[model samples]
Target: MKTIFFSFLFFGSLISAQNSLSFQAQLPSINLWTKIPDGPGPGGENIVSAKGSVTHVSIPKLIIHQPENPNGIAVLVISGGGYAHIESGSEGYPASEWLKSLGITAFELQYRLPEEGWATRSVPFQDAQRALRIIRKAAGKYKIDPNKIGVLGFSAGGHLAGYISSTFNTAYYKPQDDIDLISAQPNFTAMIYPVVSMLPPNNTTHSFKSLLGKDSDEKDQAKLSVEKQVNAQTPVTFLAQSEDDPISPVENSILMYQALKDHKIPAELHLFQSGGHGWGMGKKGTNTGEWTDLFLKWLKVNGIYNSDQ
Candidate 1:
């Protein structure tokens, strides 16, 4: 029963913007089972997304970036770390900055990484559910349209966003408060080169091992394969993946798109020729740098973003 209080993050003018709703983080009121077979031994930064990324995480926090001119659109942005750490600087703040420039409010959620002694397979989702519930309850303060709330996740986080969007109806924990009554469902979801399946061959072994142990049964893995979990009510999805992504196969996005298409769910897929994997908003010359523009256009096309709001 350890509790950790959150510390507010101030990134100064370079990373700060207007009209944000950064909530104070609290320890996990509800604990999910965990299997941390490997201990955190002298954790440090690992170069990822062309930036120094933290390698271990425990508590969850929200760092919001509101647009200078809000369009009543908000996206909860989740960073990817293969369930090992959070690329908060490269994947979290940078994305929020770009979204803010688009007049779309962005909430960067720092969720607990699996296999970190704080969570099991369901822990990340529980934290996501709680984060969304808080946003939905305080929608007005953030000046967002609750129904227009969406999720954008990078890599493993992308998998999480898609997984939560489809499985929002399943309750894995008891409600905590009035805010818990709010649904965690996203109106739209975006997965950027995500590890979408728990099944091997197409998915990353580390992420599945972190969430579900190496000894987990086939049925459990099948249950978490997001492509097979989509239903008629699943939200519209936007996927972006590099054809040559070394870590996560392009087939993950393809399988998810096919599932959405078969279920008649609105979906969009982008497969770049290069860009490799985990380029975080791209590294200049890469064509993946243009993904933000395409995402904005998609949002506008879906009427999720409007200048008039």
Candidate 2:
């Protein structure tokens, strides 16, 4: 009887230790705040009734999931909330848990939102880059492979992921942290219903204007379009979108796939006839949930998924 009691205690302690380790491996929290100016007036000649600024607003709530295999591959996840708020359920937790089940480590990134500032277009972009560097720095300790690290983003977060894929070499800000020296480029990118264009002829996404602080000019607009940025060196990409998505048009993925093809980059696009937007892992029998299987297939074909099984 004593032996059995000790055995139960040992197993219980082991489980508790594992849970503690998991929590410690996630993204660290940072200070963030928004400041609004004091005033009261009706607009007729001159009035700035409400003006605000975001200060000490650092990226927080990054959560990491370490895989059982301890292989080198890791994926950073960026959740989407229309650049306004983060959808923790659809865009964050479910995806992270699924990646863990597949023996793939995951990180959930919570970047700054538009309520912070409109004049600054590079803050959130810089945050994405920094997150990658942090992963690389702790590669060995976290059992992650630096070379196999990738990124996945949804909706507006997809736009940020797309930006990182294209401008990996661009230095947006000075590196201050220990992880700064590592490259920000993801080995591959998985974008779901991403917004790919902001230029005229296709200028429809208002989120871009709000983030950029002003409507993009011809040159700047062209620069923001990820479709035009694909190259031979760009990471392997997998794109999925619903044909009926009202917020992000399906054409965005189509155009990006064509660009990837032009550069001979490994790319796969899956467009469902009807899934609408933000179905997130999807409801029962919905098409969006099946995307996970398709993504895994792509990973296996690319040699990213280990075949030790």
lDDT (CA) per prediction: 0.72, 0.68
Model 2 regions more than 4 Å off: 1-58
Note each model's CA RMSD in angstroms: 8.5, 10.4
Top-scoring candidate (TM-score): 1
Candidate 1 off by > 4 Å: 1-52, 307-309
At residue 211, candidate 2 shows an lDDT of 66
**TM-scores for all candidates?**
0.82, 0.79
TM-score of 2: 0.79
Candidate 2 local lDDT, 1-309, one digit each (tens) = 343334333433343344322333354432211221111111122111111111223334356766677666788888666665555445555566668767888887766555554345566676787778877777887788788889988877787887788788888666565567778889989988888877655566655664654645778877878888887778999999999888889988898899889999899999988888875555343466667778878888888887772
Give the per-residue Cα lDDT of candidate 2 at 231: 76
Worst 10 residues of 2 by lDDT: 45-54
C-alpha-based local distance difference test score of model 1: 0.72
Instruction: Give per-residue lDDT, candidate 2, residue 92.
Output: 54
